[model samples]
Target chain A: MLVSYQTLRARPADAQRQAIRLGEYQSHTAGLGKGCLQANVVITPAAYALDFMRFCQRNPKPCPLIGVSDTGNPDMFTLGADIDIRTDIPAYNIYRYGELADTVPDIRAIWNDDLVAFALGCSFTFEHALLEAGIDVWHISNNSTVPMYRTSIFTVPAGPFRGGSVVSMRMIPSERVDEAVAISSRFPLAHGSPVHIGDPAAIDIADLSRPDWGDPVPMPVTHTPVFWACGVTPQAIIRNAKLPICITHKPGTMLLTEVPDDADVPLFQKS
Target chain B: MLVSYQTLRARPADAQRQAIRLGEYQSHTAGLGKGCLQANVVITPAAYALDFMRFCQRNPKPCPLIGVSDTGNPDMFTLGADIDIRTDIPAYNIYRYGELADTVPDIRAIWNDDLVAFALGCSFTFEHALLEAGIDVWHISNNSTVPMYRTSIFTVPAGPFRGGSVVSMRMIPSERVDEAVAISSRFPLAHGSPVHIGDPAAIDIADLSRPDWGDPVPMPVTHTPVFWACGVTPQAIIRNAKLPICITHKPGTMLLTEVPDDADVPLFQKS
Candidate 1:
């Protein structure tokens, strides 16, 4: 059941999702379904779902919610007519009492009636726009996970959710930083514009060589470091909440949705 | 304590809110706080707050949530430094079992620890933009309420909230419709872009002259009817849900926030 990258790239978003569901593709979903919107997934018990949703609503830059499933429903009809939350994502991170206990391909074994699934927009969508705009996305070009750092910029809290923002870094040529902002700002659901542009120290990042998450890519002298609010923010905040049990898509292996990456629909209207 | 329009317009947002709170002002909020953001208010008991939040999240066009009070805590600190939900809005429409039970200047008597306040973006923000762009908003020019209609467009429902979208009509010069869209699209927190353009019949509006709500203004031959999702939608759907009790700002009277109408922050980021 091995699918070639070329063949997978040629298929539609639903087909790519089907391949992931059937265990045929289980790696990062970077280049697959290029024009499709990919989502960061979070599943929580219905009891805490409201607070978690409020957190996302309060801090949209870090957590732009694209869809929320009906309580206890495994299907995310709003995201896609046929998305199965329990299996479509290539991987799932299971957290027990605010700590990562396991990483699994699927969560069907533990699916329950009290769970709610939330889909959040990912940076990949804007990264695609950046590439199309002729801006160099260093991480994608170098075949590495984008470097992520937890910043001193605290997210506005809601209920049990409280934490600093986690941001992804890209070294953009100083001249193109404005262009990058204009392009990325168009995709608010995808983390929007860079939260910080020049100095990492100002946002409390001690080192560019080492990222709190993902791989660090090289920075050039002519380039300026740009930081965007990362999708991993919700996961970090959820962990801080120390919920009894929570589930999220493994970082970088997101749920590929049918929505086009460039769709101009307002963030709230997307649902 | 009749405050003159000129005097109120010269004061800051907090001062104006204080005036409203003290029963010195009890009229529509248009033209007041010209640069500040105004919001449609909806208050529900804690039991229905989650479902109502989900409804707003699902139907963001009609309910772009700008600020959500922490459960039962009515000082909407995020929206304004001293906004007391019970008294800040000039008027309150109390709905009991889906019926309009009373129109009061304040709801302090019925306020309880179990109620949650939600502030949604109002169209006035964009109408301000429209006027700045030199596009004529007929109703504002005529000093009449914007016409509203219940269209065939069914909102994506959540929990007991199910209803067709309610839209506000603006007859724009056909040539300026695109300009209107571009200007308004920048404010997604406000309804953002028209849901329907041109023929009213296409969206199931039988006549532009007779609206479901608001006063209808005359449409010129050179103009085209454009409709944006109206904030009244949440009230309509909340009524349909027939919650034991609900409270909303009386039509056209909204809560003014300190955030500038033109603030480029993402909708979700505003909270």
Candidate 2:
């Protein structure tokens, strides 16, 4: 049986993590816990961990690192209590040698002491902020995934991680563009503001109808396309790197955490 | 021959660089080229470059990375158009096996193809901001160095870089503490905002007269102590790492760049 959004939506992150840990919920986490942050998970072996960390540091816009689990430890105490890297996420997409090898609910069978997990800030927080500010999100209203495109902007590379940037697009009414920029700029952890605005050719997005990933939404005559740095760029780069073992959230199956969605600060620290 | 502050102050960045590059100006860069951002320079061999980069990323409050040179390149084009990292700075402190080997006018003789320079934002930019905001700087008024202390706060470690955070203190009138924070918070590149305010013991400072580095200015009776993350923390860690060779700007001497003293953004992009 399914539960109401009120029942499952605003639960404290701990209870939500408990549900996910117990396998009670295994689905996209878009509306699971309103106002709470949902993180994109990436777990890789120790040998490639530093390189991955560098890649995130070099290209912060696409890969905003919020929390990193200590090497060989499945727990991220800094992010949440009782949060297990191997099982807390709703679903895992295991990539082997750059190919999707298996889709699993949990990874206890393959869990090892050599794995390190990274919790990256997701775009959901900013999307939530935009909606709060009364800006229309075209894809969400139309019941579709935000359109993503591979752009000409080259991400600063580190080691074997090298790729062009990827951005998710939403059409906002021309008058609401400033509000979109101001609201979105407050969430650097959520990829901050748009990487480009107004022109599709500026970042090499030639065709709006045909996106490289996600659903193509209609651009209303009054709206303009706004693009944000997408977290999916790292996944594509890792796949291109042909790492021996790489795991990520299955698109929208994010990990919920107790940390509040701190705006503009990608790496929020308690002072 | 020594030049007057009036001769060099407010000169365009190119003229200042030319003066330094010609071996004419070799002293503390405190008053040189006002309104420009001064950087704490760190050049190291390529072997330890990635680890150092990670260290800066992990400890950004103290080591705000304004610019990073391409590997083996003497040019820091991202920071300035005509920058020659090997010669532009007024002075360089060379470290061999983690020991201070010598302080030189320039590093042209030791410059190698394997060196990488990291230009870190310095607090001088924020002090300029404070002055413009009508806040009197204690050290500048007294003609003394700001007191710095090693705090109990542990910086996030990356690889071999590990150390307690270092902070520099300024005494603000009790009524102006909030204003102090509000103004300083604008310069994230320049150690934005107070890491600790009011009490000295809160961050483990036992006495105002003593500092781990820099000369001390007397604390005023009506003023409360305010501290900001010092860039020296990274230098301390890098020194502790025992790398075969490292080079940095001598304590008070710094590298001046063309970037403006942006209040919130210390990492001012563009030439």
Candidate 3:
């Protein structure tokens, strides 16, 4: 299942996206399709789009922009052909005044000409790389959600957006730390490498047992917690700003894109 | 000097910049200060800065932005401390209406509050990486400039910026092609790996002998021409746009910065 350059022509992205559009698929997009990227979605008014784009540019780790829609245009042709932003994802979280108003299956009813959609690189792209390299993801193996925590590191502010970073942690044996770094760093769009390794308190995280989001997995005494800048950081920023309206894809569910996982080629062939 | 993390604090960048600023050294910056990143400078009006930044973002392979200054600011603190964008570089090329106006030792006289500066990742950064990995750059060995050609590859346009990409070619022994690709691919900011390898016709580059810029190097019979996206790409775009005014570093006489050669770090060094 190695997504090599020669094999990228296959169009699983179209079929998978169709399934999502029809509301046939509504769970986590963890292993939905191979050879293509899955993106975190954000929709906001045109007025806030430019500032939000600048925010993603300044803090690339938290929000690596895969594609930005033209004003009032719902089609993100850069990410794929015939893709409609409003109905392409399995679920959408509509926020009003920065608070969650309702969770909907489709944003088509609420989509407006003044709204702009942004597709962000998600960790699922790099997680595929890790699995291919024989690195067992702890939470995935334990059948639980990946643990995420709020860190003391503040994001670079953009317009009204400002907040501390939220990071996702994976506990691994000390020896496999290098493998984790090697596999993950290749996908800079997918948050890149570990921001803090071993010491949770370095980022002001007091406990690994109490994650701010998702289920916590048990770690062996020999394992060390490695943190990566999470896509959730932007959500935190959006929440803090309390803008007029912001719509996003619910966690786990995502907007799949046509881009290959090896957007930037990784080091070494998996021979 | 490997420019390792431990040796980065010595601050040789300041001394090298001072020598350039004093007019003490004016030669091509092939291997000036070790461990620091060298940048291709572009200064334009604040009116065009946003579009130009978007242009760089759209065409990252050709114009990889290392640091973009705050609008109307003459300093680029991201690349270095105490960086005066107008006069720090050894030389500047003033362009008016897409034509060369004057080549000056410093641009302080023309510097204005409406000007914005951009420091782009140069091939010099990756050339250092190649040499460290035992890859011989033909032009450097022959004491000539690397051959550059205007390619048929169209860059993604932003606003008024639009042009074909300009690529620089390096002749390498055919056997070392894999090694060259492996090593250079680590520096995405430095144009990453070869855009076209072996066949120039593939990229619509007709002749390698007669380059549009720089001295042409003799190619060994066993060598292949490997082309990487050149930083001159933005210059071509600027020329095409024919803006009111624009300024850039004279080719080969780049602005050196405190950032590392491997500004985009490789994987697996963490413990």
The model with the greatest lDDT is 1
Q: What TM-score goes with each of the models?
A: 0.94, 0.84, 0.83
Docking level of model 1: acceptable
Candidate 1 overall Cα lDDT vs. reference?
0.84
Kindly list the per-residue Cα lDDT of model 1 for residues A1-271, writing each as its tens digit: 7676556767887688899898777666766667767898999999998888888888888888888888889988776667899999888999999999999989999999999999988898888888988888877776567888888888888998999999988899899999999998988888888899989999999999999878888888999999999888977887789999999998878888877777654232234
Ranking by lDDT: 1, 2, 3
| Candidate 1 structure quality by residue, lDDT tens digits, B161-224 | 8898889888889999999989888888898888889888888889889998778888889998
What are the candidates' C-alpha RMSDs?
2.5, 3.7, 6.5
lDDT of 2 by residue, B64-161 (tens): 77777766788776566578888888878888877889999889999898887888888888887788778898767655556778888778776677
lDDT per residue, candidate 2, A153-259, as tens digits? 87876667898888888899999898899988777667777888989999988998999867888888899898888887877787789999999987767888766
Error of 3 at B124 (Å): 0.9
Candidate number achieving the greatest DockQ relative to the actual structure: 1
Report model 1's TM-score to 2 decimal places. 0.94
Best candidate, TM-score: 1
Judged by DockQ cut-offs, is candidate 3 incorrect, acceptable, medium or high? Answer: incorrect
Q: Which candidate do you rate higher for lDDT, 1 or 2?
A: 1
Judging by TM-score, tell me the better candidate of 1 and 2.
1
Give every collision pair in model 3.
none
Instruction: For candidate 3, give the lDDT of residue B122.
Output: 82
lDDT of 3: 0.76
